[model samples]
Target: MSEKTSTTRRTMLQGIGASLAVGGFSGLTTAAEAEWTTAKTGTDSSLYDVEYTNAGAYAVGAGGVVLERGPTQWTKIVDGGPTGNGNSLYGSDVTDDGDALWFVGSSGAIGEYAVRTGNLNDHSAPMDNTNNYNDVAVTGETGSANVYVAGDSGKIYYSFENGETGTWNYVTPGSGSAIQAIDFHGPRSGHAVDGNGKVFATDDGTTWNPVGLQDANVNFYGVDSDGDGEATVVGGGGMVFHLAESQWTADSTGDKSLLDVEVEDGDGYVVGGGGTVYSVDTTAAKFDELAGSWTAEATPVGQNLKAVVRGPNGAPDVTVGAGGTVLEK
Candidate 1:
């Protein structure tokens, strides 16, 4: 999934009213209200990936469970598919039109659901169940499209057309690594991060080249590009890297294990283990702890949050592991 930055802007306008002095009086009313309000859907089950579709918000998690949020609450759409026991749904992304949603999880499970038609198709059969697929990215174009799925053992699979059977191909960019996240800023520019603290990028999605980092101890879990070939990657040990001037530079945030990083409204937020969340000022190359910071908002569920996304209603929604946990801010 692309690390999207919340770009919401707030402004205030003031107005003055005139009053009649002698006989009649006139009054003006002024009120201030927030433009957006965020609220948690309130579910106990572990949610791995949360995405907004034309139908509504959908969250996928362990046990092949997929939850959809309606006008009022969340409902279980699908539960316990053929792959019964899986750790978690690792990746999810919506189609360009928001009419389709794709999800990949442990045990090489890959599936897509039609938001408008209630159609669900499992594409895992062609994968041969060799490795668990941990991430998926869909191109912006529709019909006869391209989709990339990354997984354990440095496996990267591609589908030139919609998953209508027999359109899958494997493209190995690296060896002996687990790809945890992937993102395509455009149809041609894309990036992937692996468990071995390495990043591979490609202009056409078919060919990839390694983009070395400064810290070998940092295993990047997520990456996002700005569609102009410039991108940012974030991962373990509070490490951040920016692709600029045809090079990657490390942007450290004072040694925090940042699990997920997202950009919204031109600002970046990195969330990680120990309830650590840092807000980065990209222009200044500096970050500060959020109001509550780590350890303050750490929930009773002491799990290492693995991934996070901007919530459906514009809040920061995070997913953690150690027992499949989900939190919203």
Candidate 2:
């Protein structure tokens, strides 16, 4: 197991004997009515990422702006993030228990925000290197989760003790090529993609081994791991790669570069450039091709969608991106 198992936000609906719900894209004669509403977070700063956990929905981006979606609308929770320097926040993830949200970005700025209380903790610039950090993932209970930060300097930073000072270390997952995305399915296992068309897996959170994609030449952007042997990698040119039975298969959904992907129990969502949205279903036992499993969903805005999470009983409960663009389906 590496970087997130089948127990995601919609893990309940993905349980055995339960019907996994998928979304309907309007203008397509396939599924639901494709109902999407543009949401306002009241900021023009680009929203780099979004997450939907049991705790709630969160969006973070440029200028250290963080927004939390309430029952009525989205509200700004942090003005300049934890750094107070206005550095851009690139990516974020909730703890395994969904009690805290951790975000990382420019100048190695990292912060942990308490979900229930508006409390924010500064945990930035570990190892004294202020290089930009790209994305983050946390595993374990809220306060004790293991922290993993992907760096633009081609290193992966880890802290086993809740990201406290002096507890962090770094590793270059593959050729020091700027790890683009990281996610964990179990407490110690997950996978990472790089800007050089490579994928790496780590079961112990410290030691990493190259997985595949050696012959490709596209920038690997986002990854969603169901296990070490079962995961999804989406990247340049709308490519979607799946790992199953220790073998990898590939397919392209469109021409846009996919920025982020998240899936649980065979249901998932992928977002990218041009506000491209894709609904995923990996329940079929296909041995070769990986096409037709993804359906295009309508985009309410043209801004490039940076990240996505499984929504309430469907795909893309929320997505945030360029210009603070948000969509709720």
Candidate 3:
């Protein structure tokens, strides 16, 4: 498939599922009013992703709106750009030290928020500006500089210079499928998923090789790893796969279309269509179907949860999705 077509299909699926969760925005409604507190983001735009930093938290969504959690309340950071519905922010990631923040969006738009420097730089045009940038992954924690961007048509870009030099080198092509999500486990080791249900692994964030999933043909929308070879991927048809050693163990919830998965405290939590979130045990090296048994957890909200992350400190996990909803459990 072509790059534009692949990315459009991926985005359309997410938009359709999430739209069905809520008919329309009704002033920031949560499934369980008491379970999750609404952040009062003001706008009713659909929020795609959120990230927590040591300084605070940030959420990005449609209309290029970005909400920053302040000491007392959530504030919108000025983008100083367009004010239409076409400008949307999809994915975001914060640096290990919490000083640097980055986000990617429609038409390959890239944004960076420098905490100490108090600067918001919009780098919308990339080498391939026509494609939508689906996800962004940064490497550091031990103080290194590398950023990876994944998008339509098996496209992947990397820059050792933190993408500040206006040079994003291309990685070797894959199956030419739209890479929906990408995550890093360590400085170099990482895994990514495409719209064709295929998985790719990289040791240095450039060269990539496909890992087999037997005969699975469902699209994989989200993925996360333990930094080791083991990873949990979720997608359409309630599909979930655990990659252990080199083999893939596939399972499903038989209902909701799983959108995102996160590995936390030896447990894997997945969120997706109809606000469904399932937790599975993954402490072992090799996972069995019985061992990877999953149970549905109570969702704080009913809107299709597009993304989830471990809450700040030891608090509850946070989930964000349709109609400007932000829930902390």
Candidate 4:
């Protein structure tokens, strides 16, 4: 997602009203088990997004910085940019098998990191549009990879060869709004959300169709699919929408503009401005706005969080955002 929110830090801190506390995990010993730990990511660049790969957790941020979390610490693996002033990497994704890592950013910068050989390369956007590449989603297994990179002006690029050779094909046509994020749960199924509160879905990733909401003016910042025909979308004004049964239902998330959301197993996590982080237990076949399923977790800092991803190997969830903050829980 892009830096669409211009509210300052002080204003955001003052807007953090009462947070809701949901029940703990079943059979958990204590409430302390639901806390987050601050992980030192070294650089102070604001990390826009994160993804898990075989090498570890990789975070992309300002100045084209990419931090890799090792067993003990986070290393600044990639710093500076193809340009001298450094580019802003807005979104990233890794293959399920952890064979490839892809990061998309400003000026159509696409960085591909190979896990096994430790080789990193740069790929240009389709037709070298130079528009800001905001989000990316990778589908298929390791050997056969299809990467979808979305950006401003409703531009979406697809690469069938892991985007290693700087080749791309435009997929989403005539979309003028900025696509903030994209996700794929099945090989031929995926979703993309744009800045104009529009949702696009593709069964083959080559053709796209618009999905309607009750309201068409809410700007969605992030979206994720659980790979079971269930998907969640979050956006400005703390909007939470669940897509199930071929319908969209508006869910409650208070008044915080949720920046990103991720669903794994039967649970989900959302993060947003003013240090808002929520844990959602999605048990209802259909999402309920008033259901007692949302819990507000404590944040170490009051900075705005941009994106979040589930941790690997039972590790804590990783969140990144303003002031170069990184948290694990």
Extract clashing residue pairs from model 1.
4-263, 5-263, 5-264, 5-265, 6-264, 6-265, 7-265, 238-256
Candidate 3 C-alpha lDDT tens digits along 20-88: 234322343333443545556666788888776544557888778887755344577744322233568
| Best of the two (1, 4) by TM-score | 4
Q: Candidates' TM-scores?
A: 0.75, 0.88, 0.81, 0.84
Each candidate: RMSD: 9.8, 4.8, 9.4, 9.6
Is candidate 1 or 4 superior in lDDT?
4
Please give the lDDT score at residue 244 for candidate 4: 62
Residues 16-61 of candidate 4: C-alpha lDDT, one tens digit per residue: 2111012211221222456776777678899999876655567889
- Candidate 4 clash pair list: none
Q: Evaluated with lDDT, which candidate comes out highest? A: 2
Candidate 1 TM-score versus the reference: 0.75
Off by over 4 Å in 2: 1-34, 285-290, 312-316
Error of 2 at 172 (Å): 1.3
The local distance difference test score of each candidate is 0.60, 0.78, 0.67, 0.71
Could you tell me the lDDT of residue 257 within candidate 1? 71
lDDT of residue 93 for candidate 3? 75
The better candidate by lDDT, 2 or 3, is 2
